[model samples]
Target: MKQAPFIAVEGPIGAGKTTLASMLAEELNLPIIKEIVDENPFLAKFYENMDDWSFQLEMFFLCNRYKQLEDTVTQYIDKGNPVISDYHIYKNLIFGERTLNGTKREKYRQIYHVLTDDLPKPNIILYIKANLDTLLTRIEKRGRPFEEGMDTAYLEQLIKDYDDAMASLAIQEPSTVIITIDGNAVDFVENPEHFTEIVSYIKELMK
Candidate 1:
């Protein structure tokens, strides 16, 4: 049998990465690897005050994602099981660069490179793109306590960063396929047809 492909769904916050990843995993019969956002102890504090907790929050995410990816390779990839993840490991760097500054940022990069240097890359990345109004609306609908009253300016920058990161990934990793989807075009969570359309897209990509 052919080895199963690893698929990662990525996007700015509230862009539906987790929901899409879950749907794809079920449709494809693949294991899902989700980011442990609620488990981050520093997240609430970081959101309340970014400058004070930026490094700690980013480091926590980096360590957790590293371990998750390591286990993913051992438990799924090595066994030829297709895997779908809500967030790609590189998201740590994307968020880290936005939060950390100067010497701290440089130091974090060194550690990040060392930790991720040998990890297997996802065969395909699905990037969900949305306008700021759509993102804010979705974020409001979700109603996560920590995410309540999130800074609009911060979210604007995050969207830009995600776009830049995806563009960079396209140029840097020519072997990996990256597909950008307009988040506003489909309500995959509420509408079955929308979900089916996305599933069909993934099936075609896998072929």
Candidate 2:
């Protein structure tokens, strides 16, 4: 049996991870498993008061993502076609660590480890990055009601964390191919060439 190809597109909010992942999936004829952010009831409150709701929100996401992947990953395994995802499993810990205290973070990691022990890691991780200003603009333009109060300070902190994670990806997980793209520079929606280049990269890595 052949292994199914898996690709994860990750970044801070509004970095175009979802848009790019959808485009890549369509272009490459792959199915996609998107993050379940909309189902998270605490998200709006968490954004409004990170100090109060961060841990709960993060745990919810961690458990939800794990459950979804467990149910879906086997279907794709060895099937030869790729599965494109907007967010990866690591985001649970990546974003969780930002708000969790030492003890709470440790506990979250322990649970996360056990839950994701057998899950398939991505064959390729596409990291999309844009300037903070660019992300803010995109987020505002999309106008999700929950995002109305999102502030620059929060976004800047998240961007810093994302960069740190990608910087360590090579040494941390040498088996996976990690690719960084400048989303601010790409016309993902209008330029077919840009989209094609991304799809080509994923295809090459899968091969």
Candidate 3:
């Protein structure tokens, strides 16, 4: 049988990924998988001393994300339920590249691949691409306490890395549909017309 539609909304931090994903989930009447953030005990300390806390933070996220994806497969995808997710498993790899180094990174990758290798891939990836200023503004508006004094340099590099990874992912997984949306130009949250436009667009694609 043909696979049930799996839509994954992905973007750099503060790009409103969860917002868009939830909206899509509601519009499409699909179950939504949201990422676990801020629950990490090491997150606050990681910001204070990245060298000391990077591995721990990363491991916590890796394990949590793995379990979420695992459940996504057995609980939803395998049973033919269409699903929408705020993140793709590849996010661990993207963040790991920036936070990890040497043997730590190598081992992290080993663990990542082991956990994610069997997980179901998204049939459609809604990639929200926004300018650095736009991302920063949104991040500030959200006012997550953990994000205070965020590193712009790190954010800039992460954006580049995400874009690069998306490019590679498209080439690597030609069967997956990759749709990039300009977050700077579109106000999906406040503009009803824009939101409806996106909803209509994605509905057509789902067929």
Candidate 4:
């Protein structure tokens, strides 16, 4: 039997990672591993005061993501079932580095590396890119209370950080393919043609 592909969708906050992941999963008939964002007790508090709660929030995400990936590998990947994930484990570092600082950041990095060293990496990554204005508008439309007061400067910095992180991943994981999708150009949520285009691209890639 052919090995199943593990695809991950990544982007900064409000970049539609979840939306695109859902679309791909449905179109391709793949099982999805979604992020448990609202379930994190520290998320709302961390967004309110990042300085005080960053470490806690990162740790919470790290543990949960680790568990999810481990379970996914055993239950899905090992069975040769195609898997789609909303966020990749590497995202923990992307957000952690931005949230934590100095000694705290280093400590978190140590823990993250140790925990993730043996986990399976995604075969392909679909990185969604959108302008800040588009992202803010989507965030507003989503109507998440914790995200309503998100700092503009922070979001701008996050976009830069995400770019840097993706670049670094390209270099570090040379074998893994990264596909960039223009979120601003295509409204996958509204336009069927745009969604079909993306699905077609992914099908070609997988083939």
Candidate 5:
């Protein structure tokens, strides 16, 4: 049976997930769901002192994201409305594992599973993979104050973790379709042809 499209654009920070998600949503006329980032009061301080605020920051995101999916995305998709989202909810765990220490990480994991278990899973994930330097440059250009102090080492690890998570998700959920995009390959933003090509590719896959 042809499945209803529930698309999620996923990758580490600065990988252009939101940009691509917007592009796809516009092309398909789908409702878009973006994560609540700037609204997180702890986000600014969390970046500055990760060790001190990891749990609080994570819990805040978890609650907010849960609300978004529950209130908006799920409601639309249940009525057969296609949905596109910038961030996959699972990234919370990928990040929580890296930032939260032993006990904290374990506790967060329990909470994450409890919350995400019944959440709607994305049937299509656009995994935008970019090189470290490319991501760093994009992050700088975006100029978010909280991201100014982002650690290169942390970003590097996130890149690796995201890739690993995608692979595992593919195996565990065979029904989910993952479309991996090479960020270094094309400037989809600056180049219309490249953007069109990406959209075309996604259309073909969705068919």
Candidate 6:
């Protein structure tokens, strides 16, 4: 039986997930779903005091991601076509561990595991990797107010967590479809070759 087509572009902050998602959607003639960052009412405060607002911020993201997944899952069941998203369901948990404290982290793990139980996994994941300097530069270039005081320490920790998660994911689902791409080489927002490469890759995946 042919499975529903789903594609995800996942990476740490400033990795261009949103721009890539949008471009992929355009090329594939699919709708785009991005992270609910703007919807988070606590994001500004969370940026100011990560320790205090980490749990709260993560909870908001968890809820938002679940809802986003629900919508996509429904579409897959009904329409049986392609969809592209900026982030995957489990990426929320990745951020959760980096942001939440010990006790809250445990709770986050439990909820994340439960919420993702029946969520549809992507047919292919495009993982973008970039160094800290590149990431920081991209973050600043974007000029989001909430990202103004972003700490390098927090970004570094997220990088480690993302690496650990991808490594474990490879182990747990050895056969899962994945493609690791170097973000440093790709400028989806500015250049054409990088965007062409990404679109080409996704086309191959679809075939």
For each candidate, give its TM-score against the true structure.
0.96, 0.93, 0.97, 0.96, 0.95, 0.93
**Per-candidate total of colliding backbone pairs:** 0, 3, 0, 0, 0, 0
Model 2, residue 148: what's the lDDT? 86
Q: Candidate 6 lDDT, tens digit per residue, 10-110?
A: 88999888888888888789888888887799999998988999888899998988988898878763478778889878788788877777888999999
Candidate 4 lDDT: 0.91
TM-score of predicted structure 4: 0.96
Tens digits of per-residue lDDT for model 2, 91-151 = 8877888878878889988999899877787768999888898898889988888988787
Candidate that beats the other on TM-score, 4 or 5, i.e. the better one:
4
- Cα lDDT of model 2 overall? 0.83
The ten-residue window of minimal lDDT in model 6 covers 168-177
- Check candidate 3 and list the clashing pairs: none
Query: Per-residue alpha-carbon lDDT of model 4 for 95-204, expressed as tens digits?
Result: 99999999999999999999999878898999988789989999999999889889999999999998998899999888788988888897889999988888988898
Q: In model 5, how large is the Cα lDDT of residue 41?
A: 94
Candidate 2, residue 180: lDDT:
90
In candidate 5, residue 124 scores what lDDT?
A: 89
- Model 1 residue 104 distance off true place after TM-score fit, in angstroms: 0.7
Off by over 4 Å in 3: none
Give the per-residue lDDT digits (tens) of candidate 1, residues 98-134: 9999999999999999999898878899999998999
Residue runs of model 5 more than 4 Å from their true location after superposition: 1-3
RMSD of each: 1.5, 1.7, 0.9, 1.4, 1.4, 1.5
Q: List where candidate 4 sits over 4 angstroms from the true fold.
A: 1-3
- For model 6, the stretches where C-alpha displacement exceeds 4 angstroms are none
lDDT of each: 0.91, 0.83, 0.90, 0.91, 0.88, 0.83
